[model samples]
Structure formats: C-alpha cells, structure tokens
Target: MSWKDEIEQLRKRQALAKGMGGPEKLKRQREAGRLNVRERLDLLLDSGSFREVGSITGRAEYDDAGNLIDFTPANCLFGRGKIEGRTIAVVADDFTVRGGAADAAIIEKQIQAEKMAGELRLPLIRLIEGTGGGGSVKSILDMGATYIPFNPGWDQVVANLERVPVVSLLLGPVAGLGAARAVSSHYSVMVKGSSQMFIAGPPVVAGIGEQVTKEELGGADLQLAAGAVDDAYASEADAMAAAKWFLSYLPNSIHDLPERRETTESPGRRDPALGDIVPRDKRYAYDMHQILRSVTDEGSLFEMGRNFGQSVITAFARLDGWPVAVLASNPKVYGGGWTAEAAQKITRFVDLAETFRLPVVHLVDVPGFVIGTRAERAGTLRHGARALSAIYQASVPWCTIVIRKAFGVAGAAMMDHTRFRYRYAWPSGDWGSLPLEGGVEAAFKAALAGADDPDAMKDDLNRQMKSFSSPFKTAERFWAEEIINPAETREKLTEFANLAAPLREPRTKAPRYRP
Candidate 1:
C-alpha cells in the first residue's frame, strides 16, 4: 500500500478510537438527566472559547499477539476556558472511560492543570462525578504490590482553595474522593435527584452495616444541611448556571480586585430607611439586611454563610463599584447573639476577606456572645475568643459602624483598631458591658423587694434604665466618633472605602487552609 494510503487509514483508526463509547453512551447520559463531561464544559465556559489540552489520550491496551491498541481520547477533558470573559482552568471527568477513574496519564493531566492554575493565578472549577480520579480494582495488577501514593492533586486542590475561589459541581453519583473535592471547595453545588455523594457506595457499606441507598447516605439535601455543599439545584444546567453566577462576584484571582457592574445609583446615595432602621427602643429587633441593602448599591449584596450562621451575616457588597466585605449581626436570630458555631463562621469569613485584602465594613448590633450552660458546653468561649483574635489580627482596612447594641467584649472586638482605620457610629449606637435588663434584675433586686408595689417597682426600674440606654446618650459622651443621620451611612461608608483603597496590602501565596 502507498504511504499516503497508510497514513489515511491510520487517521481513520484514530478517529474511530476517539469515539470510544460513541453515540449510545451519549444518549444514555442524556436519558439519565445528566450532562456528559463535554456538554458540561460547554455549558460552564464561553462558547467557542475552550482550548482542549489532552483530547487524544486514553487507556493503553494490546491485541492477542501483544500488539498495541489504537490510541483513544482520555476519558477526562481538561483545558483553558473563559467564564465571564476571564480565563480559568477547566477539568471535567468523563464517565465514559471506566467512570473517569485515575489512570497514569489522566492523573498527570489533572496535576498539570492544577499546577497551571496555581502558577497562572487563574480560578479552577472541577466538574466531578463518579469516583473523581481515584483508583479502580483493576489497578492492583497494573502496579504490582507497590501502591500509588495518594494523588498530590488533593493537596493542590486544597492549596487552590486558599489562594483563589475554587468551585465544584456534582452532576452524578459522586463517590469516594469526588465527594471530598465537592466539600473542600469554596463553593459547591449538586443537582437534586440526579446527584448524590457518599464516602462509599451502598454495596460496600452494606457489607459492614445496614443497607442504604446513595441518596439516603449523601443526597443533595443531606450535604446542604450538613454544610458540606453550599447549594442544591434541580438540574445540571442549573448547577452550572449557579456556578457562573457565583464566580461573577469574585475576582479572577486573589491578587486582583473583584470586578464590578455599572449602576445608575451613586455610592454616596443613601437609602432614607437607614435613618430610622435602628429602633430607639433598645429591646426592639429590626432586620439588619434591610439596612445593608439600602446602603449598598441596589442588588449588590452577595451573602455568604447565610444558612450556617444566622446571627452574623457576611456578604460581599458593592459601593461605588468597589467591593467590600460587610459583616453585620442579625438580631432576629439568636437575638443577634454570637454562638460557638456563629463565631467559627465569622472567624473563617474574616480570614478569607483578609486574605483577599478586601476592605471590611462591620455593622455592629451584637448584644454579646450567647451565654448559659449550653453555650459553655459548646465551647462558645474558645470559638468567640478565636473570632475576636481573627478580627483583631486582620491587617486589612476595616471600618466599623455601630448601628445599635454593641455590648461586652464581643462588642468591643467589632471596633476597628487605631492602626486599622475608621470607626463610626450611627445616632442609634448604644454600647456598654451588658444590656441593663439583666443588670437591672441583678442589681435592683433589693430595691424592688422593699417597694410596696413589687411589679410596678420592677416596671419603674426597667423604665428608668431604658431611658438612659440611648445611643444618643452615649454619643454625648464622645463614646463614638460621631452620631450621624441614617441617610449619611452610604456617604460615610464610601468615604471610608476611598480612604481604604490605597491601604490594601499584597499577600504572598500560601497553602490551602483546612478550615
């Protein structure tokens, strides 16, 4: 045969090999309500944007005479792509090749992708399903008795989490290491019904204990409630859309400032409701989110840890097209009291914001840390102390705005230090060691007992204490820098942000954090 004819025949064989599972598996994947790996990458990245890296790599097989098998595209697809016009490293596990299990070349490809992301400072997104690049039983003979060391990919995965925003989407039955990757991400999502994640499959677990389905063990509902995954969606398409939406608020890399969307409203434009959002009555509770929404550019608040810590609300908000981290207390939940869990959440969030060098805007309304026997058993003290330590140690530009009820050490910890930056107070700000209700009961017991009308006397004492507990009263003593009108909040915060813009400090790359 002519050499040209031989080359043509070889190309045909290569094409045939590349079509490994062919149309049948693609149809089956569609029937299962899951997007195939390639489809997932297409949906996640910009159209016509992906530059595939290892498109023609796969299993090494042999014929009956020991001749090599034709080359096949690796069951894994990875390459560079753009999300919202920003470059990112994309890795999608193809379920067609032994469910995308760890093979030598595939492992190397993933490692290379991760390393590139780290070196280039681009964000990484993993579309993981099945066993997530882990070993298969067949591998026992492939390497003899010598075990393959646990993939350094996990370390790189964790390291990327600290340096940049890492996102994962669970589109199918994610088992073993796949579940770990989903949970370790900065943000993770799973498609309901179609997606499930577990440490081990039902058959393996059934050998040791009671039988349970994958969903029962680690369904979307299970992970969302456990805080292992951030959100759950109805479809794989929805999950991809959610991932895109999430990355929009974050920067392309930790070193870069977060991009902003244009708005007609000026940064200094104040929402009139802010003026009276904090009630004059110290005991009254108001929604802090309302105040946050009013002060920030309309539709600019992207809340994080919304479900985990109900007391403290942490969000990325835009003011005059600049990104700032806003931390405020929700008095509606736990009476705006910090619990051990809430403290831990705050500490982690503060560390994240500080690491990214985002300016912090604290809207203080905390009464204090949650108290009582239940709190002590939960190690509230240790966690609260750690939260305080994180806040104090943060070198980022911080501005504290005391809206109302900053009391005790928790309250004090909310204030920006002299070196850190500005501290402002609304006209409604009132801070002390503790609220007077508890103090009145403890200190005025004898006075109330000696009164003719005990109930009326107690009521009178409460009235007297409430009368003096005004933030305006505290402001008279210069306890706060200035008590401003609520309408002045946006202007004040914008001024602070302008001052802080130049105070940003560069951060050195570090390994990912376990938290």
Candidate 2:
C-alpha cells in the first residue's frame, strides 16, 4: 500500500479527462463536420509542442477507496503551446461538455488562463466554441439553486489586447460570453457554415417570441459584414492554418517587435505588370488585391475583414521578409472612398499594427471619405477623423505610394509627414484638393461663364489642369519625394521596409496598444 496506488488513481482520472465529452460525443463532433477539442489543438500547434495546464481538473465521483468511479473534465482545453517556435497561451473550450456550461471551477480556470497570458506577456489564442462558462440548466437541477450567468476575467482579456496579440477562432455556435471572446481579439476567424456567434441562441431568444436559426442570426457572412470577424474558412483545419499563418508576422508581445523571417523572395523583385496595373484613367478600376500581392512576398498577403469595409483593404504581408501592415484603397467599391465602416476598420487595423510594431504601408488611390446622405448620417466624418488621428498618433514607420487618384482629406490621411519621407509616387499618380475633372468648373467658373461655349471652356480647363497635375510637377518642386517607375515600386518599397526594421525593435511606449 505505497504511493503506487495514488499514482494509478491519478492516471485513471487523467485518462478519463483526456477522453473529453466521451466517445459518443466525439463521434457526434466528427459527424457534425467539426474538429474535437484535442484535434483542434493538434492542428493549431506544432507537433508535440503543447503542454496542457489543467488536464486533470473537473467534476469527479470517487469511492471511499479513492478509486475513480465517474469523472467529468472541464469544458476547456488550455495551457502553453508553441506555434512556429513562438510560445503562446491557448484557451480552447470543449463544446461537448454539457455545451460548455458555467461550472464554477471551470469559469475560474478560464479566467486564470487569460490572466496567465497577460501576466506572461504572451500572445493569447482563443479557440472558442459554445457558451463560455454560460448558464447550465442541468447544473441548476443538480445543485437545486439557479444562478445568473456571467463571466469574469474580461478586464484581463482586454488587457491582453493591449499587451500582446490576441486571436480567436469560432468553430461552433457561440453565445453569451463566447460571443464576446470571439469578437474581442485583434484577429478572429470563423468556420464557414459551421460557426455562428450571437448574443443569445435561438432557444433563449424564442422566449421573446422570435425564432431564427443560428446561421441566420450570426453566420460567417453576416458576422464578417458586421466587421466583428476578420476572415472565414471552409473548415476547422483551414481556420487552424489561418491562425498559424497570421501569428507568423506578429511577436509574442508588444514589449518586442515581430521577428524577421528568412526569405527566398528577393528585395529587388519587381512585378513587370505593376506598371500596367493602375489605369491612367481614374474612371477605370483594377484589382487592388492583385497589386497588393505583387508588391508583397509571394503568397504572403493575408487579408483581413474582406466582406466588411470593402473600399479599404487592411492586410498583413511580408515585404522581403519584413512584416508590414498594408492599408490600400479599393477603387472597385465606392471608388475607394472611406465609408463609416471603412474608417472604423482602418483605425482599428492601424492600432493593431502599432500595438505589434508593424510598419505601415499605404497604397493610396483614395477618392476621399464617403459622400451623400447615408454617409453623413452614418457619421463618416467622425470615424474618418478618428482614423486620421490614429495615423497621426502612430509612431510606426510609414510609406505611402500614390498609385492613382488621391484627393481631399482622405488622400491626405495616407501619411502625416512630408519632409525626409520614405514616400513614392508612380507614373499613374494623380492628385489634387479634389479631382481636376470636377474641380475645373469650380476653379474657373467666372472664365467659363464668360466663354461662348461653357462646355468647351470646361474641356480647355481640364486639359490645362491635367498638365499641372502631373506627379512630375510635384517632384520638380521637391514636394513629392520620389517618382519611380511603376515596375520599380516594389523594389523601392523593399528598401524602405529594410530601413524601417531597426527603428521598430526598441519599443518604450507606455500604452503600446490603443484599443
């Protein structure tokens, strides 16, 4: 009767906890096209790199002999893990355990996991499914006491956003606290068709006389459009891959800068087609995404919030192995204007970059902030001003490239400096207070009124302004830093990225991340 009996008892408990919601539940998870808790961790972390923290914690039933009779593991899978050799804290909830009910100890454990990430200053990854410590109707029946549902550790979670990188992946239905955790991260991913996030599920909302399916309430398409989720993947494996790829450019914490990676992609690599990508005519549009990919490392352009704020594209990419946060205007939507939603997206994206110390790259083709009645009602100007303030306040290195039309305040928002700037303009660059096409009439109104043919006078004025609007004129006055061939834009940009690398590594800001 030595310590061997105690060791065997502990092993028995651990084995049962590892079984998760049990064999029957694992089968149901696979049938529903979702990866179980353990499988998700395997897919996300490097092989044999996960060190689980609380594998033996949960409700249990033991006999007087201290032998395990029945055991129920916590609904969470958490601990320290490595993704690509970088250590991070992970919190993945097991939905199979009574649908991730709010068992008291499990809630405390989840809170501790979040605090550990913040205290350790490590990037936190939340693979959330089901309610996060949500109400358990069955638990109430067992305890014979009903209690209100709530989640602690929100403050620690928010602090994690400012201290380190945070990403959340929603692989199943998320309600209550789970929904909050899903959207609170700097980056979030949802599995298409299989995932949904809502304030309350249909069953709870049905009490209010409303009935809607989970997908209809908070599907991937809907959440992405709402700008709460960043990207959507076809399956859990795809989402897992996405999460790993995203963390590649980010560091473990804001106390340091993102690590530079070895690259076969040459710094001088130029896309010959870049010269022809931006049309000479402002009325015509080209794919901004294609241009982004061409300038970035091959196959390294990871886009965020694609469905929401389509006019402005925010992406994380590598330029010759240097990680960069790219903000590009998409003329394909609203002629590249900054809508209210787009402004919000840009401000948040810029904050993420500043938090993680990623240098900013602006591919400017902005037409200005969104106009018309809807734009004003949505307070586009307020959001635009906030975005502008973020750009002005950020101390991160900035590089601007005027690819096409850049007009008004939105165009000016591209960068805040003019002297000794690492900025470039392509041959297709065209800029003014407003587009010359529309401004010519206002600028020479008296002269046009006096002309016999107002239409002809307008055409003459257009030709005259076009000549003055050349990027060459701006360069002649030294207002524009460099006007390079479009083919050489990427090469020049790579040089700028290299220059910015050292400046970012030493970070001493008290508020490293501004929400």
Candidate 3:
C-alpha cells in the first residue's frame, strides 16, 4: 500500500478503538464519579509523561462466519510514568474489557512489566480491580490438551516485591487473584464505598452455605480492620493522592537511597506536651501516639496497620526531611501490652523497613506480653518469637528511646541493647526482666505470710522495689546508655540518623529472607 493510504487506514483504526464502548458507557462512568483506567493513569502520572505499552493488543475472538472481532489494547495497560517527578512503572487493568480477565498475552504483559520494574530498579504501582488475572472456565478450551496448571509469572511478581516498593490500589471490585495482588503490595489502598476485595465473589460464596453482600464480606472496613489493606479512602482521587504521598518517601530503586526535601522545620523542634505525656506512676496509662506526634516532624507521620495491633503503632515519618520508621507502643490499648497479633504485625513491618533500607526509631513503652488463657491458646510464644527473630535479622540502623516501662521479653524484643546501634532511655523509663510489682509478690511471699500484718508488709516491700527499679537505676548500672530529657528526643534521633546514614553494609552471602 502507498504511504498516504496506510496513514488513512491507521487513523480509522485509532478512531474506532477510541469509540469502542460508545458514548453511553462513557457518560454513565462520568455521572458515577469514577475515572476509567486511562483517566486514572492521567490523574496518577505527570502531565504528558506516560509512555504506554501494548496499546493495540486485545482478545483474539471469531464470529460464526470466522470474522475476527479485533479491539483496542488488551484489558491490561502497562506503562512507564512519573509521579511527582519520580519515575515509576504502572500497570492498570481496564475493567471495560471483559472485566479485566486473564489471557495468555495479558498475563505476559503483566509479567514483563514486573520484570522491567525489577531489572530497572523502578518502583511499581498496580491499579488493580475486577478479576485480577485469575483462571476462567473458558481457559480449558483455549489451552487444549497440553496446559500448565499454574502461571509462571507469579514468581516474577514475588521477586519484584522484595526488590522494589509495590503499591496497589483497589479502585473497584477485586476478587480472587485480584485481591491477592492488592494485599501482596508493600502498601495498598481502597476506595471506601466503591472497592471490595475477596478470595471469591458472592455467587461462589453463596453455594458454600452463606449468602452475603460483597461489601458485608470484603468491604473496605473489613479489610482495613484485618490488616489486609493499609488504608481506605472516600474516593478514587483520594486513593491516588495517597499513593503519590506514599511514593514520595520511598526511593525509585534499591541502588539509591530515598531523596530528602529541604524543609524550614528544625530537627530540634519539640512540642511542649512531650514533657508530661507519660505519668510518673507505673499504673497510669497514656496514649503513646500523642508522644510520637509531639516528637516527630509536625504533619509528617504516615501510620500503617492503624486498626490491627492496636497496642503498637508502626509508621513512616520524617525528622527534618530524613525518612525513618517509627515503632511505638500504644499504652491506651491493653496498657501497651504485646499480643500474638501485635507481634506478627511488627515483624512484617520491621522486615519491610529493612528491605527498603530505612532507619528504625523505636518508642519503647512496653509493660510485657499480654498474659492470659486466651493468649496461651493463641500461640503467643511462637508469634512473639517471630517478632524477635525479625528484629535480630534486621541490618538497618536501629535506635530505641525508652519512654516508660520496658519489661520482660517484649521489652527485649523491641530493641536489644546488645545489637542495636544506639539506645537512649528517658528519665521516666523503667526496665527489668519483669515488673517489680509481680516480682515483689513472688519473692516476698514467705516474708509477708509470716508477718502480723501481711498486707502492710507487702505494701512496704513493693515500695522498696519500685525505688530501685527506676530508669535512673538502670542508667547507673550502664544498662541504658544515656538518659535524655523529653525535649531533646527529636534532636538526638536526627543526629543518630545522620550518623547511621553513612553506615551501609550490603548482604554479601546471606540467604533469602523468609516470612
């Protein structure tokens, strides 16, 4: 064909693809307040910066007369884009095409995208919705007699997860494989009323004896509470905004450290409330989050697992422009006690920060593990041990600030004095193998039993033990490195972060991280 004739044919094809679903569907989507896959890409990426791949790929289907029904790109969209000036790889599913079903070519597209992100060391963001590339009954006919039971691309996906930051956004109904993709991310977000995620849809679930609405079973509230998703938003725009905010703190690749922005805020800036956030009495409880908010850079704390593991707080925050992961005990819940659930949450979080080479700041206020029949039944020992293992395996710089009671195995697990790079205790901090109250009862049982006034004698013994159990006593013994004023915490942490920044040690011969 002549060059002029070819150009006219190409334009006609492009026009037809652009009008695939016609105007009614476009108008309905506009009225419903949800952005389509292409629109979402535009909103997420820098203006005119997205370079699309596989735009002309689609289903290979035939009519009764054997005529082909060619369409635009396949349901999946893969591209390279810039978010807030930082380059990233994006894979978005077009729900308009066969509900974004899994096909051989589309699966190859996803695998290639993941491989590109890993090999190039770029962070990947998946705009997941619909079926999420799961197997369909129609696959039986497509594969004929010789078929592989499992997709090979899953391995690449898993490999990319450990190498770079993976973010997934649930913009619509995510089922089966789709839900897995969402949770497999280092971070995930869901739009409140619009998104629902589940292993199986309501139709499949109904056959198993229970009939429930999608939202009731796998709603944003349910997933957030279960720690399956990191955050939920009221709208798609909010979800995209959050994704941008999250990527701002992470590096584009493992070869580079996260970039820091210049800030007018000083590292020594302190909130007055830190001085008295914790009460002097051991029995009193206070919100550790309040203390964290006061000490870290103002308006910089981005919390993770907020609903699950309520006793502990894990978040990313900036101290004068440097990113650090803050792990604090929330005394408001269970008196800052650690449970099996809390232990699992902490382990996962610490591993993530270590993978990304982020420094850790521990705000210690642990009393002990939650002890009861329920705790024992829940395999608390095994889970708590996992948390300890993760902390021990961490290679990144760690610093702990003992805010209050740091007692028993839980305290030791928070930040081991022997292994941690830097450790500081506040004046009000207290540390022991066990709290003095329980120890006094166990050690002075005989003495109190023989006394004329057992109650009075027990009270006296408790007071005596409390006096020697103060944080200053530990400082005197050189168990705690130094005791600092509450106001100096931000400055001290920032100095330590700078000191630790230059201390980089790569894993030379270590085995792959498990769990």
Candidate 4:
C-alpha cells in the first residue's frame, strides 16, 4: 500500500538487468572461452569491493496497463571498485548485449565512468570487448536515419590521462571505437588467444577488397611488435593481475606522490657476481636482466613493452621498496645503440615516469643512435632527439650508472649535466665520442696510409687510445663520477632512492600526458 508495488517493480527490473542477454548468449560467451563482463569485473577488482552504477538504466518494455514487461541492460556497465584495497573506477563492455553494438550502448554511462574517475582522482580500468560503442547498420535502419560519427566521451578519456592512471584490457574481438579505447591508456594488455583489436573486423575489411583473419590482422603478437599495446598474457586472469601490479607502482593521482612499501630486503645487499657480469671482450653481450634484478628489491621488477624495443629496456622497479623508473641499454641488440623504436620507447617511458613524478634510474650502455642505411630510412635521429629532449626536460630526481659502453651523443645523454649530477660508473665503463675500434680509422686514416706497417701503426694508436679509455683516468680528472665496483651498484642505487624521496613532488600541469 505504501508504494510497495513500485518497489517490487524496481526489483524486477534489476533482476532482468542481471540476466544480461539471457541464457543462450551467455552460454556461447562461455563456450568461446571468455568470461562475462560481470565475471571479468569480479576477477579484476578485489572481492566484495564493486559498487555498480547505472545498473537499472536500459531499455524497458510495458503493456497497455503500464506494467513492466521486459528489460535489456545497457552494454556499458561501470562503477567504483577497489584493487589491492585501492579505489578505482571500472568500465566494461557487455558483449552479450547486442554484441556490444551502438544500439545497446548507454552513452551517458560511458561518459560518467570517465568523469567519475577524473573527478574523484582514482585510476580507471576498462575491460573492452565486442564493438564497444561502435556503430551498426541495423541501428541506422531502426532510426530511419544516420548521423555524423563522434565519440561522446572521448574528451573525458583524454583528460583523465592528465589526472589519473588509465588502464585498458582488450579481452575479445574489438573494432572501431573499442580499438581506439584499447590503446588510449597509460598501459594496455591483451589476452593472447581470446583477444584481437582492429579498426574494423574481417567482414568490413573484405568490403575494401582485403581478406584477413582476426588474429593475423590485429593479434597480440603483432600489436606488441607494433608498440600499440604494452604487453600480452595467456589468459584474462593473468592480464587482470598485470593491471593490478602496474598500478601498484604509481599513486592514485598525479596530485599525489608515489607510495613506498615496507620491505625486509637489505638496502646494502651486494652481489659479488656483478663484478664480472660484463665480459672483458667488448664484443660480448652479457645478461642485463640479471643485473637489473640483482640491484632492485628481491622481486619488484615489472618490465613493460619488452618486445617492441629490443635495444632499450624500460621497467618499473623498487629500490629499497621505493618505486622508480628503470631504463637500460641491451648490449645484445645493436650493441645497445638506440634505434628509432628504442628512441620512441624512451620518450614514452620517460613521459610516463615524469607524469607520475617517479624518480629516474638509468643504467648506461648505449653506443649511440643506430647508424647506416636502415637507421637513416627509419628517421632514427629525429626520434633520438625527442628522447634526448625528454631526458633533459624531466624534473624528477635523476641518477645514472655507467655499466659498460656509452658513446657519441647517446652516451652524453646519460644524465642532464645542468642538474645535480648523481652519477656513478662501473670499473667496466668505456665511453667516448666514439669507440676506438671505429674512431682510429677516421682519426688516423692519413697516418695509417703513410705508415710503413699500416696494421702495426693502427694497433699502436689503439693502445694509446686504450690508455686514456680506463675509467680510473676519467675519475681522476673528475669528469666521470666515482667509479665503483659493480658489487656496490645496489647499495648506491638504494642510497639514490632515499635521497630522491624528499625531492618528489606532484607533476606540474604544463606537460599533460600523451597516450
């Protein structure tokens, strides 16, 4: 009598929303080895932490009596959630609802999700599937008209990057708007066999006279190689876990500083094997990964974009439990020379770190920007200049460890000399405008040509250059910072973290993040 009938009607609608495209479609979704949107949310967020918004906003049908008859929930579902006990906003596309086509999308719900995250200063995670807000021809026929294409909530999506962290997961065949949203994040991940992202799926591509399968067109492997997404995993659960781990290194928003975790690992822990990690032969490649792991907290290294840039390594790791961005050169690839891809990767990673106010730690081993025909064609110099600009413009606490080879303009970029030079060098440091092997020919070309014994003359000139190449000579002249034993690397970096902690500040608004 006291409006009890209306309350019951609301409950009926809520129940209908939960049904989500009914039994058969859900069964097919499971058969395809994918979890429903709700299930994916549960896996991504902490247990009992989700508070769904707009649960009952969808299409409704009624009889002549105005009694409720049926309801179909909107495809865009979003709400507040927690990951590792930290609050975040999550938006997911329910593919079961009209294949997540535009006809089934609730535009307001998409807008609110991004707005809520930015206004509340919380991270946003998107679980993208199906077409998301992509248009469908059937919807046009239903309306008897068509309109200009526009993304309703795109401004909010772009603005959120400047305020908070945004992560996206591509969990199924994504096209059009879905694909755009997938890469429009600070970090993105895809499930290997379960996900594919493209501008348009195969059926549409065939209309353009090109036939391609989903995997071949935009598979995880191809996207990773193309640097469109940060990483990929074998399963949805793994991808969700990765998203959680990635947020652990950053703060809730750019207005706040990164959080530090308490750890029992000794800051002064030294690994004697580091002394010999680099081989005496300059041509030989050593395991940089091992050195990275050895110097940070026992198990806090999380690498991103591993497949895209083979010459450079970018990762987030902890030094004495304080989060820092780690950049290193891979001696195994192009002798750690920065290629165009590596240069681009550097710009992206450095921007990310600068946006979050994380301190920078660089392990130097670059010979220069990669040279020759391919490098020139790739515009390596332009990209390399952008990377150098990022390094100099960054205001974060900076530290550099000269591990082995640093040469040419790339070598000089190890640290910004204008700032406080928190720099150290290993006994193995070998840096110059150019390595002696190649420079000897250029510098002594005429001398060698006139020598009675050309080969012997070149060898004698190399020995003279080697005498000056010793790191101790640079240290004596106070040009290079202290040259320490490789075993002392961890202790030195841990000290840097402690020193850098006080210098941390919220990112300035001048340079907003670029996806």
Give the Cα error of residue 229 in candidate 1, in Å: 2.1
Off by over 4 Å in 4: 508-510
TM-score per prediction, in order, is 0.88, 0.94, 0.93, 0.98
Candidate 1 global TM-score: 0.88
**What is the alpha-carbon lDDT for the whole of candidate 2?**
0.86
Task: Name the top lDDT candidate.
Answer: 4
RMSD in angstroms, all models? 3.3, 2.1, 2.7, 1.2
> How many clashes show up per model?
1, 0, 1, 0
TM-score leader: 4
> Which runs of model 2 end up more than 4 angstroms from their true locations?
63-67, 137-150, 418-420, 444-451, 510-515
Q: What is the lDDT of residue 514 in candidate 1?
A: 51
Predicted candidate 4 versus true structure: per-residue lDDT over 214-270, tens digit per residue? 999899999999999999999999999999999999998898999999999999999
Write one digit per residue (lDDT tens) for candidate 1, span 1-515. 46997677566655754565567877778788777877787788889899877665666567998656655566667789998788998887777666656653367777777777777888888888778545776766676755655745777876787777778888888888767877777778888998888888888899898699889988988876566677788988888887876777667667776665777888678677777677767677998999898888788787765767678888888887778889999999887889887888788778877767788999988889989999999899899998898888777788888888788878887954556337778777777788876787778888877889978878888898878877667667866667788798898998887787777755665433555
Clashing pairs in 3: 57-74
RMSD of 2: 2.1
Q: Say what the RMSD of model 3 is.
A: 2.7
TM-score of 2: 0.94
Task: Encode model 2's per-residue lDDT on 126-228: one tens digit a residue.
Answer: 9998887546677678788876644588878778888878889999999888888888888899999999999988888889998999999899999999998
Error of 1 at 13 (Å): 7.7
